[model samples]
Target: MSAGDLPDPAEMTDQLLDEDTVRQVLTEGTLEISGRLTDASNLTLLAVSSLDGVELECVYKPIRGERPLWDFPDGTLAHREVAARRIAEYAQWDCVPLTIMRGGPYGNGMVQRWIEQPDDSPDLVDLVPAKKIPRGWLPIMRAVDTGGADVAVVHADEDKLKLLAGFDVVVNNADRKGSHILTTAAGGVLGVDHGLCFHTDDKLRTVLWGWAGESLPDSVVEGLARLATGMAGDLRLEMDEYLTVTEIDTLARRIDYLQMSPLYPMPPRGRSAIPWPPL
Candidate 1:
């Protein structure tokens, strides 16, 4: 959808703010720090933005709170998170929520629309008994559990997931654990915590490799084409604000390669293909 045609809040299932209103709240509203997500590697804050009686829930990851990574430049993760959302928007996939880089209570950071997942939302990626992989789930790997029982790493065989997998390939996402995939009450899929994405190298660690070696769906190819078209024009300029020139060039190259091959990439050789603590 175009910037003017933001998807309805109802489609987001739990969000009461429309896209424009949410963006307004994130950009110009009063931010109130409510809590912290302790499990987050960075100092992630749970916050609410209020504007003229409209309140929106959001996650704030301050740049100063970011933990330095040996690979990614310090303080750049927040920018990368915003860039990931831009890429998704360019691809017309809507796989990521509205994300922006702005000043928060702590400091400059990435602010994103908080997704409220319904309790009954289905699991997209999961660990199940090896012998009983769900009917429509594709197994990525098998391992012996701590109890010595065989278990499998699997994800649902759904188009939304396939689209996300394609998105990860383009971004070279270095972390795509099961927990990163959020299923909304509307049954829409949203991916979060993208600080590990958009690297220039082949650090594509993820658990959504269920479709490895499979042909890319026609819709996915169309999305890639859209991204490519953007890369050649405004998208490159936009991403330049966040990623290095080499990184943006590498992303363009990945899009081109995928279009030529039109298949899901195989797990890279000589590397751990999945993230630790897969969920």
Candidate 2:
């Protein structure tokens, strides 16, 4: 199913999407995969209609419905999705959309609460005249046309987007494409499609390099510290259930490194740091 099949988000909603209610629905809800979203990877991206005690819209990815990846093991992407959200939640970065793994029409899979981003929100990256940038927006880079006219690529300096930058680092997210950043009428930024994350190796490919060398905010550092300190407790246990022991250890190591530095790390030399077709 395409985005056109979902409810419009331009209109505001005062009624919160209750997490507890959503959890119940995602866990026990009846699923309807009426069609497939075509612009996805080898897997079928399903627009699902969920019904437990109430009706809701969601996206479902059944494990048995995916194509194999050489680097990633089969049937583990669902766990990675939930694990990524868990790590983000633990850090109090609510950038990730609410997600859970559950049994579905095909088999156990990942189901994410669909984020109805308001269409009016500005693109995460947009061209702006160099001197006309609004206050609180960050200038990404300057580009000059063949005719020598200059423009700046700018991003909204929203706290949620900054938090998501750090969140991607901690999760080692490998596929944070521009299309994954969802914005709400209330200016909430929710990240989705987190199936390639938390691998043992460094694989942080993302479009969120706007704050590449900036200092981490005090609150963001505090959150990473909390995650680092809790590695021996419930965090380790929860991750162990899905990720390999090596990957879990690597996550703790990454958190430790984040806590040790105040500045966001620079991209490695000779490495392709940003994801392709960056917005």
Candidate 3:
């Protein structure tokens, strides 16, 4: 029988999907099935029709795991859902379109807007040839080229840095790998993978180095301060139903850090060194 025909977790085991379809989507430790979900968990995948009339992909986490690498606890699926909603609400920006959908192979997974791009794209990590940069300061150079400095350097867009900072705060993201960032032909940069976010830790990690140990722009600093000061009220009114108090508090702390010290310390090299995780 196909895996799709199998019974859901809460149902009898005899109702499981047929083996053939499960194998079809399973390759190299990844599964690619397409169907209307009947139930979902953190590891489950759901396919839904998009506003554009095309089916899209989404992941659902009904339970958390143990000792999660990021701040999130294991088996904390509800927390992830709340965090996603909180980010979408706090940012007041549609950077991520988090939707609730039903009728999938697994069940109901939070359907996030999908970004289309080539499998191999130039990522910020590529800017550094070796694990350690020779000059220990190439990001500033790239930023300058992308208009991160006096002018837009990479994509000739000055506002990119600001948006990046905003995303970091909204998600309380601990890791911001180059792969997590998607660049569009229109010069837009998008961020993804917020599962490891909204934790009360100083876990900000990223590939951008231009602003490290440097004074932050007044505009960005001010924006962080504004968010920090109004987080409690804003979050309560906007995301209270979805997010927990702890999650909101963690987001507030991240904003506070940005406001208090815009320029964070650089990561130390050597034995304690590890490449940023692909978030």
Candidate that would win on TM-score: 1
Clashes of each: 0, 2, 44
CA deviation > 4 Å runs, candidate 3:
1-46, 50-71, 81-85, 92-104, 118-122, 127-162, 241-243, 268-279
RMSD of each: 3.4, 5.6, 12.2
By TM-score: ranked, best first:
1, 2, 3
- Across 132-240, the per-residue lDDT of candidate 1 in tens digits comes to 9989899988999999999999999999888899888889899999999998877899999899998887999999998899998877899999988999999999998
Misplaced by over 4 Å in model 2 are: 1-15, 127-154
Q: All candidates' lDDT scores? A: 0.89, 0.76, 0.47
> Per-residue CA lDDT of candidate 2, range 1-279, in tens?
222333333431223646666666667768877667788774655655454235566788888877778878887888898898888888887788778888877878888877776768768766678888878777755678567889776777777788888888888988887788888777778888788888887788876767888888776898887797679698899888779998899999888888777677677566677666555
Per-residue error for 13 in candidate 3, Å, reads: 40
Query: Model 3, range 1-279, lDDT digits (tens) per residue?
Result: 443443343442211323232222221112235543343213544333322112234443333222344445654444555455455545454344343322333443334444456555444434432234544234332222243433211221245644564566446566566566676444556665555666665555555544546666565565555566567575555555545677666667766776767764565453222223322
Off by over 4 Å in 1: 1-16
Task: Please report how far candidate 2 places residue 97 from its true position, in Å.
Answer: 1.1
Clashing pairs in model 1? none
